[model samples]
Target: MAKAKKKSPSSIARNKIARRNYDFIETLEAGLVLVGTEVKSLRQGQISFNDGYINFKDGEAWLVGIHIAPYDHAGHLQHDPDRSRKLLLHDHEIIKLQAKSEQKGLTVIPVSLYFSNGKIKLQIALAKGKNVHSRKEELKRRDIAKDTARQLAKY
Candidate 1:
């Protein structure tokens, strides 16, 4: 057999709530600013994204609420779990995201994080929070899709 292709260095930890809470509008890949211990923790997939989000302010993009667990081997320089992390993005992308975020009800949220070419990258999404009805509709649609897939497999 031919050798299997390796999976891309994708999504170490994903924010499961982000998908059900918002319609996936657009996704952008951005670099992360991490310290030594934090980077080590992330590489081991010891991070959380449930409440993380990107903030654009004063011409900078920051990732807030992402939690990188303290590296067990740290000797006294452990990083803070809730500290804000800077994100690296192109100037044009920043401008566009800034413009888009100004739209009513639109927000910037982090979808996932992963390693790319030995460096950590974040997947951020431009999203709008779903109201109760919208979330219900999404659940209904997902159930329908699941049923359809199951029926197709039976043939």
Candidate 2:
């Protein structure tokens, strides 16, 4: 009898700016449609989340503004670095996301990208943008927590 292989998930890249700029309401994992060269680029950690966000069109979700750099050795057949890629999600999930995103100040954004069981997956979140004052308060809270932890450790 053949044994099933274990699936070891690995992280590729994260959108740190998304964490600092927004407050996440909910998060979900999603599949991505990518070509060979794009996958190679991702494996090389050649991706960026600058201005990236999820856009729904024709009842489908598309990943926009993310940049996957061309594979260094792909030559002339390389994929476009900035093309909008479709996200693979169930019909019900799409509907739910679309409805939630329609609310004012709520938006869908990609939080991170990784590989699971040899397939690439995206971690996306439904989030609301944080105001400057709220961001400042969050930073202050983090600093205070760190200080308290440090003081406790000293005793």
Candidate 3:
């Protein structure tokens, strides 16, 4: 009998900074073009979202600045940790994203990476950068909401 592969959780990683620093206008899910070693590394939870962003060129979307650590066992076949990976999206979605991203203060950012029905998918967002004041206010609002919820629960 052959051993079954270990089942992993759906979410691989999230860009928490992107959530905190940007106000999302819209979100979309897209697939990625990854190598075998990159997939293995992602399965092992060896990925980073540092300085990651979406870049559009020649009408195609690419994921840039993300890092997927090289698999230890891959030896000679290990992929580059800093390579830009292509994002797979439909023609209409690509055109829409490209048009929206061209607007001032609007940009596309990777929010989270997860697996859907055995295929890896990336959740991206059209977002505007938040100033420090807005970020502070957001934190304050969350704190108040939490306090209100606690008091209500005490009843």
Candidate 4:
């Protein structure tokens, strides 16, 4: 029997506010088209997606507003810090996402950025905006869960 290879850690960046602002319905992993400096910057965990989102246009998906800081040692060859990067996805998935996103109040948002199988990948999701009341309820629920965990730790 062959031994299974262990996977190394690859998470690069995550959007902490996404969960609080939107309710995720589904998630999909897609490859990112990045330049050398962009990849290097991501490896250093210098990416931000606070304003990042997925845009579907002309039968393709593009990631916008993501900021990957220029590589510290790249000198003048550094890539742009903010650029619209293309996302690799199948035609069927792209069409499906486009149709779904066309619905009122629905959107596609980037959840996290990571490296998989030595390649850069992004985790995006189909999400719907959360109302103010729902946001408050989410906070309350999270607080209760935290309290419960703290109580359990004391036992």
Candidate 5:
């Protein structure tokens, strides 16, 4: 019998700098409500999550600042590249996020975009912004770790 190919989770976009900018408190997965062209664009790896965030308003969570490029073959029916999209989540989850985000310096940040079980899911986190001094200390620690690794490898 021919072996079936193993399916892996595929990422469309990632906010690579999010970890450096924010200290994560908790992470959650949510579904996206995307248009046809937007979905196609994501499949083509043409999305960016930089400066994007999740906001709760009117009892709904909305994704803002993500850019999904237009599909080339969509003719004039292409979706808006920068439109705010709805995030599908349970009411309880939304309320939890809202309560946490209401705290000072805490926010809901989109971490990455990926495909799961043939549907697109966004990974988001409740995070606190890092101060300048904290960011510098993190960088210093990272550099020290890298130096120690190099020294050990040289032995």
Candidate 6:
């Protein structure tokens, strides 16, 4: 009997740097606050998740600097591409994030966005930044691991 191939999540879309820059401590899904033109733009996949981040203000989560391109078909209702938008997380989750965020160096970062259950969703994370030296060390370790795997496959 032939085995079924497992489908990877990348079959959708992913932000590679979100994984590389910050260790994926945990992931949470929240509704993205969107305007009509922005939703249309997102459906067309004309959005940029780069340079996006989640931050807490007034005890609510907000996503900043993500670019949702203007809808091409919109005649005069263009939306801001680099707007700071609110993220809709549950009250309980928001409370948790508020507590965790107060600790030094802890931050909420936007991981990615995708459509689920026919609605757009944003994946956000709780993370601690990595220092430059640590980032370099992680790269070195990854290279060594790749080399080791290659050598083993040849045997």
What are the lDDT figures for the candidates, one per model?
0.88, 0.97, 0.96, 0.91, 0.93, 0.81
Off by over 4 Å in 6: 1-13
Predicted candidate 6 versus true structure: per-residue lDDT over 25-117, tens digit per residue: 677988878899988887787877788887778878889878888999999879889989998988899989878878888877887778776
Candidate 2 pairs with clashing backbones:
none
Candidate order by lDDT, decreasing, is: 2, 3, 5, 4, 1, 6
Report clash pairs, candidate 6: none
Which candidate should be chosen as best, given lDDT against the real structure? 2
Every model's TM-score: 0.87, 0.94, 0.89, 0.90, 0.94, 0.84
True-vs-predicted CA distance for residue 120, candidate 1, Å: 0.6
lDDT of 5 by residue, 94-116 (tens): 99999999999999999988888
**Residue pairs in collision within model 3:** none
C-alpha displacement of 22 in model 6, angstroms?
Answer: 1.5
Kindly list the per-residue Cα lDDT of model 2 for residues 1-155, writing each as its tens digit.
99998877799999999999999999999999999999999999999999999999999999999999999999889899999999999999999999999999999999999999889999999999999999999999999999999999999
Model 1 lowest lDDT segment of ten: 4-13
Q: Which of 1 and 2 is the better model by lDDT?
A: 2
Model 1 scores a C-alpha lDDT of: 0.88
Q: lDDT score, residue 59, model 3?
A: 86
Over 1-155, each residue of candidate 1 has an lDDT whose tens digit, in order, gives 89967768866888999988987678999998889999888778898776788888889999988778899999998999889999999999999998998999898999888888778888889998999998888789999999999999999
lDDT of 5 at 95: 99
In candidate 5, stretches whose alpha carbon ends up further than 4 angstroms from where it belongs are: 1-7
Q: Candidate 5's C-alpha lDDT?
A: 0.93
Q: Give RMSD to native, each candidate.
A: 3.5, 1.5, 4.3, 2.0, 2.1, 4.6
